[model samples]
Target: MAAAAAPKSNAPHIPVLLRPLIAAVAPVQGVWLDGTLGAGGYARALLDAGADQVIGVDRDPLAHDMAQGWGAEYGDRLRLVLGNFAQMDDYATDLDGVVLDLGVSSMQLDLAERGFSFMKDGPLDMRMSQEGPSAADLVNTAEESDLADILYLYGEERASRRIARAIVKARTEAPIETTLHLAGLIERCLPRSKPGQAHAATRSFQAIRIAVNDEYGALIAGLEAAERALKEGGQLAVVTFHSIEDRIVKRFLTARSGGGGTGSRHAPEITREEPQFTLKSRKAIGPDDEELAVNPRARSARLRVATRTDAPAGQSERSALGVPMLKGAK
Candidate 1:
């Protein structure tokens, strides 16, 4: 089903690495996929860069609506799907190239009602798809130990136990329903510190959001699906924000590109399966100073690209990409 319409707002979503991302993906007059069509930014860029057609997938209905608006302008050049990129294989048939711009979008974060940001005073709802259980449910209902584990594992928060204990104690007296309340509680749990690094509640909020949305799970499935969907010689470009996400991309690309240490020459030439992809760039691409200056969010972003190789004869095409191994596969 088509996504509902987005509310009219003038806030501009600056696309990160517009030139480099377009150049790396190289969508040239063929079917291209924007796996995380956050603001329709990359899809619009792909169309402008001479792509014949683009398929945009987003879990957020708002993103699909934004794409629909762009579709009206582009006229048959775009298709917006109300689904997650993890299902790309189900939706994108005979894809030429795919770009997965991972992480939360500025649009969602900026909207107070979306509850993606602690800075905003809204309900504790961080689900990207808007259909899943809200962050409030997780925080209010989960056991203190489970909550602590979520914060520690996903947020990397060192004081997860203290924070979770505080949350459970607070919720017993009153449900932690608002973003600001939770943010305040987390802040209280943390020791006061210098400014500018990040908010005290940042990690805890991130952990909750990740847990509510199962973001890491979706990411692993999405990357595997994108790899399976691409045609031989087709490229895959991924932009990740957090270390957890970036590490997954790094390992996936490394495994497919055969970057694991090869054994010594003395050992018999161990011929594992042929590499599935050749590295497009030697190292991960970060946003340039210019892009970073304009968009502070670009600071944490990392881009990696690879080109698919021809499958061995008589082997299933899907097998060419190798087993879909993720760091924290669900």
Candidate 2:
């Protein structure tokens, strides 16, 4: 395999926390899998860092298309798979390492046609795989209460009911068809944003996108898949963008590392068994000043790393992971 090349000025997007992530999992080698191979930043880095082979998996066809150009440089050493990371175990097992960078890819957000950005005006579609129900479908058809649940639970939007009511009202006049249309509607429903604060529509858009993609559900499933796929001593490094994601990763690691105890003071004590993984650190790695200077988008990114144990992989209770669920969702 070829050595990893220096980052190009025209690179699709900067890989957040790349330096810290590499350092945390130093001496990167053997066969590894990159679960969220968006722009192939991590994949390229791993390959360059001495991984003999890297399987890049993503559900978005855009990722696969983009991979064709740069991936050719690595030839057979870099393999691309068009599927969600939740099914990573089926792709390969006994892996040396697995890297999952959660959240929408920068490539997807930069493309207006992909409808991930509020800054860009385009369709209301937020499908990572570019299939299934889109943001537009949910915005126009979902019941007001359900939309409210998504906004409050997924995006942590405080004015969820207000926004949901507005959406229901606006869609009745005509379908909420485009990105800007929905963004504008949401902005109208909220108070004006203060300088340096996120846009008024930010939380609502994030919630809608999460609902449209089943991101949280897939995240838990992917973590479990990583647990099952890695061999003893295999490493798992996950980078999460928001608090909710970071919390889930932290809890999953805690539970698997044998720190998880009873649900509450009133709850029954749970039995323990051989743990499946060992935590590399109880703390998550965040971007340093240099990284923040280079890429402000990485400000919220958090990386957690753990090593697989010889114990057999087991399923985790989703409820314990702090996965926000809509009412009645299983």
Candidate 3:
């Protein structure tokens, strides 16, 4: 597959933690999977790194369109799928390696109509799939208590009750249908900061987007699917941009690494299982100063990787692990 010309954008979509990810996954000539094909950044990299073929999965139709332009250069080596990565098992067959870069892309946040940002004015829509109920629907229609819980749990906002009360009060008069209106409401409820602090709307917007997109839930399901899909000795590398998402990935990798858990010690050791995946690094990797200077978005990024142990191929089963059935359409 030949490389294509870079997209005509002010800043190119630079895949985060590229060096560490490539080193850990060690992509070879095989069927590779890019679970979150945002702007086709990592997908292009994998092909360039000598991957024989790649299956790129994304929920956004616009992403599929952009990938089509890229596929023209790769010829039959690229297969683009318009769907969520959470159901990766449904599409992936004979996978060698998988890479998942979670959270919203810079392109989505910059696009006003996508409604992923609190910095810019746009509609209240925050559906990553562009088909589900938006942030506006959740804020306007959900009960006050439920809304408060979502902000508190997903957003980690200390003044969740106050924010929920403010939202309910404003929506009673008129629907909170725009990004700026909601950001303004959140800012009003927050106490004035001393100095050198971010806007109060940052956390609220993050929380609402998480709730609207079911991001945490999707991450859990996607990880389980990736685990099940990998062949023994295959690798899974994930890059997360938020603390909440990182925590989930950390816990999952830790559990799989046999770092102590509540399971019976007498029963078969978890690490001895057929589909075991060993941690490639003790701690999550972060970008160096050079990358951070060029792309500020790299600051919050964290990468975790694991390699599938050498066990009998095609003998692993998800039923043995009893992974929870995921909610929502993939």
Candidate 4:
């Protein structure tokens, strides 16, 4: 196979924490699976770093279409799969390693038609797979209470009730059909963002997108699938772009690594099971000043790595992972 070239400036999106992630798992050999595969930054980096084969998985068909231009250079060494990473193990098992970058891809957010960014004006469709229920369907049909729960639980938006009330009242007059319309409604409910703060609609958009994609559920499931698929000693590295996701990954690793803290005084301590992973770092790794200077989107990125243990893989309790649940969530 031909060697993959260095990423150019015109790339769709820069993969966050790539250098640190690859460096932490150097001597990158064997078949590795990249669960996100958006922008192909990590996949190309893995190929360049010396992976014999990279199974690039993405739920978005756009990712596969974009890869066709340059992916052929690597020939059989690069394989692109279209599907959610939650079922990653179904594609390959006993894998050498796995990499999952959580949250919306920069490419998806860049295209206004995809409806991921509040800054854009497009259809209110935030479906990563381009199939199934869209953000519009949820926003226009969901109950006000459900919307509030989604905003508060998923996005941590403190004024969730106010936003939900506004959405319900506006939808009564007309269906919320576009990104900007929903964003405009949300913006009216909140104070103008200070210069350094995020946009007024950022949190609401995030919550809706998460609901539309079931990202949190898929995240925990994908992590478990990676555990089941990885061979003993195989590395699993996950790059998360938000605090909630980082917390879920941290809690999952802590429990799986047998590092879950002792139970409180009232509750009897349960015996620790055989650890499924050995944490590569006790704390989450963040981008340094140099990376922040280069990619502002990487400012909130966090990378966590662990090596699979010989113990049998098992499902983790959803409540333990800190993933918030909601109905009619979008």
Candidate 5:
């Protein structure tokens, strides 16, 4: 389940914050891994930026197929693997760097047949690996409370209970099987979006997609995997799209890099482990106006880059990172 890529591809998918990411991790070289590999934008950039080799890892089979069109030019320089980035440590130890772009790719979202977007009409299948219980199954079978928790916790949607109730009632009438079908039901429970706002079903769809794909779990595991895989001085750069995701990445880096302040007398300053990483910057980097003009998706994207150290790698508290978990610990 490992992959590498060539210097180029017909990847129309724009790599958001490409300039900023490259700038933040300047002098990119050695062996790098593109964990997301959605259209191979980051892989190509890293290869072009003088990485001796680039390993492109992605769980989606379609990504591998897409890479085939242009991956051969780099030959051994570009290796493409088929697997979740959560196991990135197993792909290659001592990697010079790891790049992860979280959430659904533009390619996946644009294609209605993939079902990642409620804006489009397609099957209720949002599994990134194209395997496992689909969104349709989750909607049709998961308990009402679970659905409510998913929307409220994972998505931060306030109307989760009402929408969950509606979903349970609607499915009883008939199985919720399509993107539009489910979106339509949720829309009825919410107010219409204004001219400048997002669609009514945006948050609900995001929550379900996150649940169906285990995105947050994969994200935390992937960060840990990056820590375990990177060599001393190697970098880990992540680009997140939402507040929750940004918060998780920010907290993970802060904790691992020893950014947490000393505790008071009542708490007693506990001895801390050797720092695993050093933050490139205290604040996340974002796209400039030029990049934003070219890619509006870059608006919400935040880049957080840090370099791994020789310290032993360990897990960060999940609650500290704000990873939303289901009630039954399912």
Candidate 6:
């Protein structure tokens, strides 16, 4: 349930913020893990930048298949593993560094069969691992209120109630089996998009996909896993493509780095645990004008890096990180 990459198969595969990422964690050596190895862009760059070995971990089988062709040139320097980044601690411990690109790859999005995009008409199956109760199943089976919560909480869609109601009404006629069918249904419930605006169904589509993949849940687990897996002085670099993703990463780093201040003026200053990570920068890094000209997709991307400390890793507060959980979910 990594971040789903925007569909851009026709476009060149340039790893977002690759240049700045390398510069941020310069002198990259020792074993590194690329947690969301979408298209293997980060893994290849890490290897080229002198990492002794890059362990590429991804839940999607497509990523591994694609890596087989390009990763071969790197020989043993590149190690591919099939699993979620949430279990990264199980994959390797005492890592020199970890790089996570949360976005789904263009290969998955561009292919209509994979069903990651609303633009293309495909089965409503947005499962990143290719195994799950797919988007179609959720839409056809979930309660209207549950659907509304997913759209509002996960995608920040304002008209979630209306859309969910419409979905329930329509599903009775027939199952919402394809991407365009759902997209069109969502479009009918919302105002039309103006020039330079996103599609009317964008938020709803994103919400359904996120729910199907459990993206936010995976993201939180993955960050903690990175903390447990990394060695002291090990760097963790994350490239987030959306505001929610960035906010979660920012808060996680802030709390771990001991920058989270007291809740209120009257609140007691409690003793804090030893900081687990040190922020490389107080602010997130974004694509520059030069990079934007080459890849506009990088425009929304933000990079955050932090170095591990010797402190023992601990669970992060989900509310503190703004992770949206559906009601009735623990």
Compared with the true structure, all predictions reach lDDT values of 0.81, 0.90, 0.80, 0.89, 0.88, 0.90
Between which residue pairs do clashes occur in model 5? Answer: 2-80, 2-81, 3-56, 3-79, 3-80, 3-81, 4-79, 4-80
Give stretches of model 3 more than 4 Å off.
1-12, 193-195, 263-275, 310-330
Which 10-residue window of candidate 6 scores lowest in summed lDDT?
Answer: 3-12
In Å, residue 10's CA in model 2 sits off its true spot by: 1.4
Q: Candidate 2, residues 1-330: lDDT per residue as tens digits? A: 111222233778789999888888889999999999988999999999999999999988888877888899999999889899999999999999999999987778878888898989998988988888999999999989999999999999999999999999998899988889999998988889999999988898888898898999899999999999999999999999999999999999999998878758887775668899999999999999998998999999999999999999987977899999788899
Best by lDDT: 2
**Which stretches of model 4 miss by more than 4 angstroms?**
1-9, 264-271, 327-330
What would the TM-score be for candidate 2 when compared with the true structure?
0.95
What is the alpha-carbon lDDT of model 4 when measured against the actual structure? Answer: 0.89
Candidate 1 residue 255 Cα shift, in angstroms, is 0.3
Cα RMSD of predicted structure 5? 3.1
TM-score of each: 0.89, 0.95, 0.88, 0.94, 0.95, 0.95
Q: Which 10 residues in a row give candidate 4 its minimum summed lDDT?
A: 1-10
Q: For model 1, how does the per-residue alpha-carbon lDDT over 1-330 read when each residue is reduced to its tens digit?
A: 233346566544777776788878764668899988888888888898888888988889888667656668888888888788888989976678889888788888887888889898998888888886899999999888889888988888999999999999999999999999999999998888686779998899888888888887777777778768888888888988888778778777777676764457777776677777788987889998888887898998889988887753122223223332323432
Clashes of each: 0, 0, 0, 0, 8, 3
lDDT of 3 by residue, 1-330 (tens): 112233468454778998878877774658889999988888888998989999999887767767767678998889999898989989985588889999888778877777888888898998878887999999999888888888887778999999999999999899999999999999999987658787888888888888888887678778878877887777889998978788788877765655535577677655454436789988999999988988887989999988876653333233323222223223
Q: What's the true lDDT of residue 123 in model 5?
A: 88
Q: List the residue pairs that clash in candidate 6.
A: 4-104, 5-103, 5-104
Q: Which candidate do you rate higher for TM-score, 1 or 4?
A: 4
lDDT of 2: 0.90
Q: After superposition, how far is residue 229 of candidate 3 from its true place, in Å?
A: 1.0
What stretches of model 5 exceed 4 Å from their correct place? Answer: 1-11
Pairs of colliding residues, candidate 1: none
- lDDT, candidate 4, residue 147? 92
